[model samples]
Target: MTTAVAPPLLEDTQLGPKAGGFYRYQNIWTGLGFGIFLGFVAWLVSHATVQGSNWGTDMVVTCTMVAWVVGFNIGMGTFNAPIHWILGHDQTHEDELYAAGVGQGSSRYLKFCTDHKVVGTQYLVLVMVLFGVGGTLAMMIRTQLITPHSSFLDPQTYNAIVTIHGMVMIIATIIMVSGPFANFIMPIMIGAKDMAFPRLNAMSFWVVVSAVPCLLATFFLGGVNAGWTTYAPLSVQAPAAMDAFAMTIITFVVSVTVAGVNTIVTVVTMRAKGMTMGRLPIFTWGTVVGGALGLYAMPAFLAVMTMMITDRATGTSFFVPEVGGSQWLYENIFWIMGHPEVYVILLPPVAAVLEIASTFARKPVFGYKVAIAGFVAIAALSIMVWAHHMFTTGWAPNLAAPFMLTTELISIPTGIIFLCTIGTLWKGSIWTRLPMWFVYLFVWNFIIGGVTGIYLSDVPADQFFHGDMFVTAHFHYTLLGGAMIGATAAVCYWFPKVSGRMLNERVGKVAFWMIAIGIQVTYFGQFWEGFQGMARRIAYYNPHYETANQMSTAGAYLLMAGWLVFLYMMINGWRHGKIAPANPWHAKTLEWKVPTPVPLENFLVDPVVTSDPYTYGEGVPDGQEVPESAPAPEPELVPAGSAPGDQIDAGGAS
Candidate 1:
């Protein structure tokens, strides 16, 4: 009987690679190995072509970059599809994918796990890392600006820091709203077992992961000095690091486009039987619009990057004015995607706030249909308004009014968002929970942001404001103040649901007020500076602007402190906080129908939607349908090798 114990049921870690020869594909070490090996091969060929010349240095860069991308794909098992297809081993392997790394253990956080929840958790971790990196860069910029001259970095180094920070933060914002929420929460809310394309969903996230290291490599190479927009001949003349940035951009675009398609298909094809388009959750609608915008807008920018890279690598001079190409051409193409891309990032976080508002307000979402229509209107108008960014560039005078008008027209749809939030809270049972407080914070911040934006919408105002800090202030208010605030609210509301433990309520509220006040203090000072003739993107400034600059920098530190509190709440809350029930907030949505630490497939089976997604009110009897908050069960990722009720302990000793 002792001999028949069967080696005590080895867990994944215990079942080591010792049994499987050399290649442990699921390991991160495997990927790094592949990247280094491929980079060497590329360098050898590159060295030969540019042998004994200064070009040899840049050749090593270009070769190494290509090698990194390929190696990452291979190491992460992203190439398994092609390998399976080539071998004729029945390429349909969904069964294997569905079962891979299906657990609550931290090990699944690495190595391309196919489970949506696993992927979502991984994304949450990555997004925080990006924010930390970007925030540090921002602090550095602000630190240098605390005086009248550059103290720490040369002008060129400062420009690179700014560029890197801007790109990282932009990418982070895009991921913040859509990546984790859409992949993890949307499927469950819509009553689907998984996204329409599960494997592709996994692939999209993995590729984004692969692109990060490549982008970081830019700092070590001569860093990218051109801004994130990477306009024209300026970008073409940038050092070898610009090549790294271009490759990262292409890789990111491909990842996002894949996500865009996956989200649209999933929403269109995978909803529950009774959940029609009109009955869909507002957040779902946001996801759909965001996805559609990305689908249509990303490819044009991809073309832009390809040409930009072509100009850099082979000197074709596609954007070189010396060769008779125009800088305006690049601006036109980039902003075409650029302006809509802001809306793409903006919409989902707005929707998330709306959804969170309805839940906390204990009322139906006000003007639900109108809000959907408004999202549509904003999407349509966003593409046409890209020319507004070009107003100060001395484009055709005849086009100025039309661009200004289109830019101002965007306010109408944004107004509708304000309408939804205010109307929901008008006469409802408002729980001033940490989440709803941030909703109110958004209302205040976005109003300031939108009104300031209106000032800049006029051609004269934009021309006056364009090269100064006011435009910078306006941009930050919209993206960081609006979208980023809404995104933060989503995290607070959904953190318990995701982690199976409630965040400390007291700490959350304190964090919210600090962050909101900090942003106001920070950006408001910048607004005055902008109006004071303070130039944008410069390390040194006039002494008259120093007081405002000091104010801005101090407030930024406050913002950083607030973020640190949030990080503490999340880390401490995860391990030792109160365990939450399935429906702690007592809301009636399809997602909350399951037990905490939601089941492996979300719903045990596909649920049937019975009515409109927003059913909150005094109308539905208190006890009619929504379940009471129950005690948290011992969490497990489906209780190893047993039936539903047979929950096991962490070490499987029960």
Candidate 2:
């Protein structure tokens, strides 16, 4: 009788003594630490609530709370595991369970692990939930607008709902770029096992989860009446409900910072041996630049929010104009983070669409280097253009010219992204796959969005359009056209890879057309209404605006219906769709090379690259076909305890 061979050890040696078993303990300690810190802060806040003081003490307390939340995560081993490995923890796993092509969902996904894929799904599901909530609020707002002076909701309740809707959408925007797509796809595209700092990754997500309920609590907490900007003097004078808004913003800022740091470190250090900076996928590069902006830009927002909290609670004068503080300071700092924040949300999806188009067209990205350079240019210029939002507010006229020039100049780099998309599609074999179709639509929508942006960038035109429906139309096009479409395309393209099943193509196409048409009907009416002088954020308006409002309300229903269908298709696809083979798209990326369901530790042995990822058609050789050599055929999905890497030649057997 033959003796059974011993299974190879599968410990995460790179993580040192704090590897597998210790995560449980780490979680426990982290929870305890957070509870104690929050308890003390609550005590102080209660005292301030009772005292009714006008001293600047509230600012100090809010700052202390923000510091504690941010600092504890840094201290108690959240981001420590990745840092440990990066600094030289010398253990290695040789077991089949740890190999590439193995597929197992980690406990970390259920808990808070920093795996980009887990964070990506977390962001996707979280954003979807928020989107639903925001949409519901929008329906209520429209009900009020269904007729002039209708009072479908009281002004207070209406304002609260509208404020929450805006805040939810803002948070959603932040995650749309950084969370699902960046976290999930960046590591895969860069050919890394996971994010550079996984624990920090988990920490960032958990922070957001903790903050969200508190934000939603505002509905019951006396309700924030000011819009998402929380413009002070108004915010300061509003009910205690504003406290919840301030707290949520502070928590969100902390979460964004953690994510930003993780992204920057991961891209800088963890690329595959051959994946140089220049060779990085455009989407990954977009994440890098956006992450950099988030890290630096978010602090100003945190500072401003901290000041607002202090003014509200401690009776400070930071933004109370009657108390010698300047309200404009708040506006300046808010937009400082605000405008770049838009780019932060928009850039990744644009980049993702570019990558999807290139892959689907079976061509090299037309201008890979130029595309990356464009992202860089956008990031740098985004900071300068924040003042453009302030143009109608009466800053210097000379300042207006500079802001206008910088704002218009941004279109140049943005135009390059458009050119790259068109070039990739030039005479290419166009497969009308769901993802590709969305990419084509993205190009069309973004072109319209970009051009309309020019009309707003000019100071003279903006003077007439600021705060009008025209402004509303411009942003909806940018946000919905650019960000929403990109996100849908990514979900469609990656559904098979992520879920280990194919989506229903017929249903997906139906969903796409509905959304496309719905968007046009919803926003196209707003442009004419805006040009005719209808204002946003008002519950009552003149009858002259009635026709446009009626049409917009009708379009909103269509938009909601389209999203419902899309959601249905996604759910059905996951549960009932056909089992997918690896590399269903026949693409050359390393992520698609992995086994379906993807193993716990990523790859067993490290991957070695010998072929270019963009080669297609006649350039791809027999036996060396991109899909064949990239992902070896598996007779069946590997079960637990099997050697996933043993079935195929990862780097070709020596």
Tell me the number of clashing residue pairs for each predicted model: 1, 9
What's each prediction's TM-score?
0.90, 0.85
Per-residue lDDT for 1-654 in model 1, tens only? 012221221122233223221223454666677877787788788877777765455556777777887887677766666576687754333324322453326765676666677677777777889899999999999899889885788888888988999889988888887888888888777766678776677778877877788788888888888888877788888888888888888888988998889888888778765556666778998988998998878987888888887777766667888986778888888999999999889999999999899999988788887888889999999989998888888767789999888999999999998888888888989998888888988888889989999988998888789878998888889888899899989888878888899989788877887898889888988998998989888987889999999989888888888888888888888888799888877766677776678665665434554466566644744221222322144123222123321121101111
Worst 10 residues of 1 by lDDT: 645-654
- Every candidate's lDDT: 0.78, 0.73
What is the alpha-carbon lDDT for the whole of candidate 2? 0.73
Q: Which of the numbered candidates is closest to the native, going by highest lDDT?
A: 1
**Model 2 lDDT per residue over 151-247, tens place:** 6888888889879988898788778767887787778766677887665777787777656765786787678899887877888887767766787
